[model samples]
Target: MTVIIFTVSVLCLLPQEVLARWACVRACPPSCTCTQEKSCSVLCDRSGLAELPKEFPCEASAINLDKNRLKFLSERAFGTLPSLKSLSLDHNNISFITPGAFKGLSNLVELKMAHNEYISYLHTRTFTGVKKLVHLDLSDCNLFSIPDRIFIEQTALKELLCFQNNFRRIPGAIRGMENLTHIYLERNKIEAVAYNSLLGLGSLKYLNLQENRINVIHEQAFQDLTRLENLYLNDNLLSDLPKLAFKGLSRLKMLNLGGNQLTNLSKTWFSDQVELEVLYLDRNQLLYIEEGTFENLTSLITLHLNSNNLTTLPFPVFQPIYFLGRLYLFRNPWECDCSLEWLKEWMENYKLVRDIPCASPSSVAGLDLGEVVFAKVNGTCVDPADLNLTTASSEITSTTENRFKSLIFTLIHPEFGDQMGNGTESLRNGTLIESEDGQLSAGVTGQRAWPSESLFCFIVMWLSLGLIGQSDLFFSLYCT
Candidate 1:
């Protein structure tokens, strides 16, 4: 570990805190229990140290000054440590840091500055002497930012953990770390990412970007990382997957985009990823699945898609999954209708397994679409005594249609009295009088009268005619 200091103006007015720090740095005992190999790897850990140890003889390689009531890091407190590699300053109350405080360290490897108080505006050359630095972690630090020249001299950095920060934009200096391969920027306030920020080194392989407020990414932001593999961009406000966002990557395998505002996934979303294998799209507001969405992902094996709103799986939804073996469709509010008839044959005919487990919203929970939802759903009932064609019979469809027509008239025209029957010469022989209507109405068609009105009027007319004849005879008898 080497001393890292911002080589700016030196402190001229030494406060009492600085006076105490200098006293400890030069006059500490030759040996202590908390220090090892010229470094206090576990010192000042809430152990009888009300204030920070001002002086640590430059023999310690690593120090643990966390969970202390230290209120400041006086200039040169850690400025001259020639052998320090790692430092723990977590859980501290030190808010003030003089410029050039850590000016001479050139071998620092890991630095933890989590859980601290306001330290904004990292002056340029803040890490002046630390040239072999690697694994710099500032997670949970009350830091607004480091200067654009923070990683100016150190290039051996491989992993950076900076999640839970206040970064609102992609750090333009990130492209300077050519050897960096893994980056953790999750759970942050980032809103946008620029492609040009990652223009060099091309060595990033794993990117953890979960739980961010990101809504946009330049199409070419990831064009340089040829070896990139796993990408996690879940829990975002993305509505669509840009076509050129992953333009140059050829080795990407797993992509997690589960929590987003994507409404539909079409082939245009995956037109470039020919090597994608595992795709997780859970907890999204997707409404449609376009067949072409997976056309280029011929190597896909596992697809997780639960907790969505879907009415039916269209025929084209399953067209591209020829080699698919596992599918998860539970937790989705599926509206089963006449369209469900296709799912049964869709599984058996396509040799797909019919094992689906229901998730929340108990309305459709624990029920299998093919075996339970469809098999026992309200089915058609057959009228055994029906003179019309039955559903059980394979008779001509036209016959069934005609029978349905007759049933409709019989059931709807109840005033027709005996009008419900087939009315064939054989069926009606004992009923309605033939040629009851004036126009020789063979049947209830255009020339025939309506069943209800015609029957009622004809009956009245017949009764009146009979009364007229009787009245004439009665009058004659009276006259005699």
Candidate 2:
């Protein structure tokens, strides 16, 4: 009788809203705790809750029922909480959420139902009244299949995290969600990305498909994602790439393609990715790269090609990347031979934070390639022009003076004059080969031909120096 009188006295002393909140707290189930601070909250986590807590606070704005034994959420689980904004039911034994379970939480903005391994299926109308949801995390749920049009009503949803599931393909559940900007589908059993798989998600900018079994991707898989910026495709079974694999990603900035079985990089692999700044191709079996492969990546800043099987790179491979700020070429079996002279020069000239280490050539096996002494690189690779000059010099040394005069005559005038005439025809005809003006004419224009005078002077100079046996002097004076 005294307790009833004290309760009546406290109720009379409280304001109307406080009295109403007190009544709601009193109605809460004995096992759950209800708090009324700035916004009412219900905490029922790991409290052996077999079902949804009964008669939770009416003004509750958040409910946390994580790590519980709850099996299902029936209709009107939290009745008529118009201001409720967030709900988390993670790590529960829930296998199903009945339709209209969230019937009246109209302002719900975030829902976390992750780690519910038994929840392999979701009723289409389970999120019936959560129209304003913006973020949903359902990762690690072991979901094998999902129904279509499951998130069609969440027009404002921006992020959907569904990694570490059993999805064999990108779930068609988000087909009509145009506002979603991020989706995580890593650590799944996704084998391939079919054509138009992600059709309606135009606003999506960040996509993570790493750590999957994806070995193939259709050319038109990501055609509708015009605004996508960051894409992660690392740790997959992609042994080869299609020509137009990245055709539609013009504004892409970062791409991760590490840990694959790719044996080579073709010239046409990356398509329409002009704005790309960071590229990762580490941990591949790349043994060759076609010339001019990276010619179109003018805006690229950072490039990673570490942990490959490359023995040598072409001379012009990095010609197009003038603005490159960082480059990685470590862990390759670089053959430090004559062909690697260009690499030595590039290492000395191009500034890099990491030194390129050589893995071959016993002398420089463990040393940085920049420190190697390329003694045979200077003009050792003979030029064709030099070879022709050497052949001509050898012929001049073996020939007699008579042949030397005849050869000099042929150089001064077209049509070798005569094997025996020497300059006799030129002197008699006065050919007027304007030697001073560097011109050659056949008949005399006004004065005697200078070809005869020049030829006579060359013969005198050769005879004075006895150049018939000295091919080096002759080549230096004439071939030069």
Candidate 3:
């Protein structure tokens, strides 16, 4: 009788270990994952499991159930985990979760229920008990709206990712979360941005609103986001930027505004973002560029201006960009004319940006406007009639050309002096060998039948006259 009683007690302990081993089996909860420690967790994605029996494995600390077909978390579904700390139910078919689903998990610190095919939504404070929660990723979960209480209760939360949702209007300001540092709300159907949307998120650092239908952004929408580092609003319809659009984003490091329909590049509109490091403005319909357009971006490293309709870049346009390292100008319609004269030296000396197509009339496309091509074609002079610059202006360019002619003519032959004296007084004084341009101009201008042809003739004439007179005198003395 004693041996039979001991065997019965030992048999009872076998079921407990078998149950723990069964947690990792394919029949686990839809939102639960079995960990390597032989513990069952609700954080695993078990969407196909329909019903969850009572008394699940209670040793779970982290549960992953992101992509499952669970509709709700009933009271008994989560009653087993007395020490659960992390629960991930994202990418599941959960449309509704009763408040009693979390009745026993007072120790839960992290909860994720995003990307589920949800018809309902998670309003504010839907996760009230999990106050110690630090990270919440609800991106692409079809969250239409959320109440203010969602962030107010989770004070210890540090990162909140709610991008690619179905939020329509300006929901609520993400205020009062003193520890929140990152927020992502990209690819949503947001139309307008109201003020104070981020009133008290002091520690918030990175904000992404990329690929959204955000038509308008209020001026002070980012009023107090001073700690913000990077902001992405590319592929949005940001028609015009008001002067105060970047009011309090002083610490912003990068801003991307590519793939838009921007016409004017107002320097004052983005003057306040002093600490910005990179700016991307590619693929826009930008036509005009005012002076000092990029004056305030002192720390900017790389600027991408590819694929725009910029026909011409005004003179002194790149004057303020002293520290600029690499500039991209590919896919722009560059009017390669006299205005590009200032860029010849830089192009020859270094790898300056010039990967653009010349605009209009199919006259000059794909032409690499370099020194040999433009100078030979005289690409600088827009019209021969505008050679109407001041006579003094003539003092500058022609001195070298004429001096070169004079020097080469002297080197080749003897008497052609009269034509050289016909130059203007100012030209004569400046074109002599004393001037800076005159010496270099001799080697540069090869066209004027050798420079100063008349000057060379005059020298030959005087020398011949002296020698002839001396020879006659010497002959007469020898005869005496």
Candidate 4:
């Protein structure tokens, strides 16, 4: 009797198992292609799907509905897909998502809804139940703001991509995201970085804010991002930065501040950036840099100060950066006078020092600054402290005829003449000229000016000085 009862129990369970297999096979929608290997995957991409398919494999782990016409996602749209780990709805017209649309996707790890231009707003509880989401992409969307509690349940989220959006400010919804490590918010319209903008995001390692319109950053704006490694704020409208703008980012490795309107730098801006490796300050309006401005950046390996209005830098400004391997000082008006004699000596030890052209003092104008400095030094290592601290005019006043010739050269040189003509035009029009690097220069009218009568005499004197042989040197200097 016991054997007969056991046999009957086995017969009843076998039919139920077969029915479960049949149900899995019959659940796949006709418009979608389903595969059931280790786990089910559905691909309904580009099938003109206006709405979510009514039936999906019960054990479906991934779904791709990209390039569809889905406009709205109703509540419980993906009902109870406990095994769903990934979903892609990119390039769709999804305008609205109900509060509980992802309610039953408890195991979802990645969700992509990028390029949905109509999603300008979201409900507070839009992501109510997808607690295990680790990566989310909302790039190229029309989101101007995000509800503060929209990501409240996404505790495991690690990376968030929201680039090419219409946000005017950093979203406050990312306040408590402790596990978030990377954030891509480039190409947005963010105006300012407010205080405590990243309050609880201590784990954030990379933050990108390039190509924005950020003009102000609060002192404590990045106090909570102590572990951040890379921070990009390039291509902004920042004219000045607070002394403590980057207060708590001690572990930061790279900081990009290129393409801005800064006229000067404060010594205290990088006081805490001990681990910084690369720094970009090119394409600004900096006229001079103080001695102690880079005192704390001992580990800096690369520095960019090109495309600025700098005429001279203070002595020993870069003596603190011991590990510097690459230094870019091109595209600036560097007056290679006695004050800059130290740069030539410094360049000898580092072959990575880029060629810099002198912009003034007609004798060396348009010549490689390194060559001029080498010629002036003449194989003698002059002590910087012992050198005379007189003006370039006083040093070259051995004869009255030479002084008159220098004055004529300054007035007739094409470089200075063109500069004066443009400056006059800018003064008349009251507009700044856009430079080749896309930064605004004060007096660059992009027009050439005719040389004065003194140019003929200056050219005759130059030809008589037997300096024609240096033409190859000048060409090679720039070409190299």
Candidate 5:
């Protein structure tokens, strides 16, 4: 009795499984391949499908309709596919999508409609019911702007790709998506970054705005993106920036500002970026960089300042980045002088120093800065401190000579000679007197004045002999 019951159970379940498989194969659309390895999958890629086929297997969980000629997505196009979790409509001629086009795809998690160039506009209700969508690709679609509230139902979306489009600004439709983590909007026409443009997206991590026309960034434009880790603004037209333009992004790891028109940098620009690891300022028109510009980037590992108009950089500008591993400073007209002596010392502790050729000072021209510093360290390069002191001493000597010449002139002037009757008395009294010509006549005002004509003559003779002996020294110090 037990054997018969076991055999009967096997007989009952075996045909049902076979029938289900047969039904799935029978329900598949013509010219489409169907598979049931784990869940039903329909692949109609490159089949030249003009429209979505009506007969899809009931158990279909994924459908790929790529490389089709479908120009329109009508209402309820894929009707009541409750089990549909993935759909692809890429590389199609899809130009129009009616309201309620995706009404019944409640369980859909991924939808791809990329490479459809004719889809320049979308209705507000185009994505009505796919609330569980986590990824969507609408890139290269020539979309200028997305209708507001088009993504209102996509509360679970995490990644959005809308790159290579005609957007002049960041779309307002993705403002409040709290779950979105990645956004690719590179190669667009975005001109400026307004303050409220990315207001409510608190969870965004990776944002790509490269190859755009972004010239202006309003102060605190990225204030709401506290969790953003990577941001790409390379290949733009930015020449200047507000002081607080990059505020509130403390967790950013990578920032690309290469290929722009920036002429200088401010120290406060990266004040809040303590966690930044990589920075790209290459291929810009940068002429000056303020000290401590990268001071707050304590975690920075790589930096790019190559291909700019920089002549020299203060060594202190890079002293704060302790963990810097790679630095690109090539293609710049670097003026290697004694002022960059500290750079040679700093480069010794790091192993990845690129060649920095000198552009000025013919003695060091065409040589790497490190080699020049090595060759000139032994009394060849003048210490800047000593140079400053020598300059100060020369100024003092010049002033002293000018004052002595004025005193001699006062002694010989005819108008002063007429006043000489009391000049001797005035000199004895240490008082300064003015001549008829309003010239300051040296008198005894407790200040140094010629005590006697004989003393002045003796001093002049002594200076004449001393100058003759030191003529070579004077020429070497001043003429060169």
Candidate 6:
């Protein structure tokens, strides 16, 4: 009877053990650890995972397989994880992805495939079943090119990061992504942007093309990108731009053109950009800008013109840009002189002006223009015409005063006055003490009628008026 009880107990314990092992296998994947609280979240990251587990929990919502040794993604790589919304395969050794690799992952929303150095190409149908994917990151993948229409089925994709690649030019078919709102393509090898290159990207708002070799941008390059707001083109090889290069970007707000080779800007370049707010032109070779080049950009809030070869800008160039809130003019070879008087006043009144330290005319070099007095910069010819008039009048007055003094000295001297031959004499008060016939010099043969008497009064009036400027003040004080 005891042996019979032991056998029955053993059978019960064996079934319980088997059931416990089955439960453990169902709850967690062999190659990954599932969170107990969520029941469907798995973390297979950095586990030396060479490939997707033979079976993943059907209810898993997130799978993080980043920093793994996965090399290839064959068809049905994840085996139809219907509930998976986010999958991270970043920092993996993924080299090839079969066309149907992501089949049946219709619920997947975000996928990260960055830092996969061996990935150079992608098949056109690689994302065939991942129609609901919203954000895709394929940056730093050593990609040289991609098949056209590779992203056509990703209708819901909003943000795409494919920077730090070797693409020689933007794939023309990328313009078909009408649902995309942001695209990052910086640190690439794109050399030029052809007209209508971004034709169908109507919903795009931000684009980054910085750190590229973009040397040319054809007119209407952004033809249909009407809704684009922020554009970055800094750190490129661009030296010039077509007049209508930004023709259709009416809603653009911020533009970065720093670290380029631009030498000049045209007046109509910004004609259609009515909503531009910030502009950067620093680190260029700009020597001049056409007058009224920024007239249409009246809404500009910030402008950077630093680190260039600009010596001066025309007075009217900034007339229409009256709403500027921030201005940067540092590191340019500014020729501080009378011509900069208006600029100095503008900068002082704007209050948000940055370093405008003079870079030329050694007298004011390294000095902040906003602090220098306008009168000193303009020198004596603040108003050229007025200065010339004042100088001419001064010379005439000096000559007349000298002539009057000589006449008065001759008449007042005892020796010269009586020896006037016809006799002409005057006292300190112009009383005319002697005449031609010894009667106070009325009118004589060789003398004068007291030199018209008015001459003495004129001299006396001038002296009393005290109109002698500094240059003649000393002479008048002692002579008079």
In order, candidate lDDTs are 0.61, 0.75, 0.63, 0.77, 0.80, 0.77
Q: For model 6, state the Cα shift of residue 339 in Å.
A: 1.9
> Using TM-score as the measure, what is the rank order of every candidate, best first?
5, 6, 4, 2, 3, 1
How far residue 185's Cα lies from its native spot in candidate 1, in Å, is: 1.8
Over 249-352, each residue of candidate 5 has an lDDT whose tens digit, in order, gives 99999999999999999998999999999999999999999998988888999999999999888868877974588888889998876777777776776767
TM-score of 5: 0.75
Q: In lDDT terms, how accurate is model 6? A: 0.77
- Compare the candidates by lDDT and give the number of the best one: 5
lDDT of 3: 0.63
Report the error of model 2 at residue 418, Å. 67
Q: Count the backbone clashes (under 3 Å) in each candidate.
A: 23, 1, 30, 0, 3, 5
Candidate 4 Cα deviation (angstroms), residue 357: 2.0
lDDT of 4 by residue, 1-480 (tens): 557445433433465456355444456777888887777789899999898886556567899999999999999787666778999999999999988988878899999999999999889998888999999999999999898888988999999999999999999889979999999999999999999688999999999999999999988789999999999999999999998988888999999999999998888889889999999999988887777889999889999999999988766787798448898999998877766777776777667886788886666778876777433356664332223333343443333234235435444343454344433321222123444665433322353222332344344445443343342233223211
Tens-digit lDDT string for candidate 6 (20-67): 443323556676888645546888898988877766655677889999
lDDT of 5 at 82: 70
Most accurate candidate by TM-score: 5
Once superposed on the true structure, which residue ranges of model 5 sit more than 4 Å away at CA? 1-23, 374-380, 383-480
In Å, residue 478's CA in model 4 sits off its true spot by 48
Scored by lDDT, model 2 comes in at 0.75
Model 2 Cα lDDT, one tens digit per residue, 2-75? 57445544554566678564654664556777777777777888898787754555556788889988888888
User: Considering TM-score, which of the candidate structures 1 and 4 is the better prediction for this target?
Assistant: 4
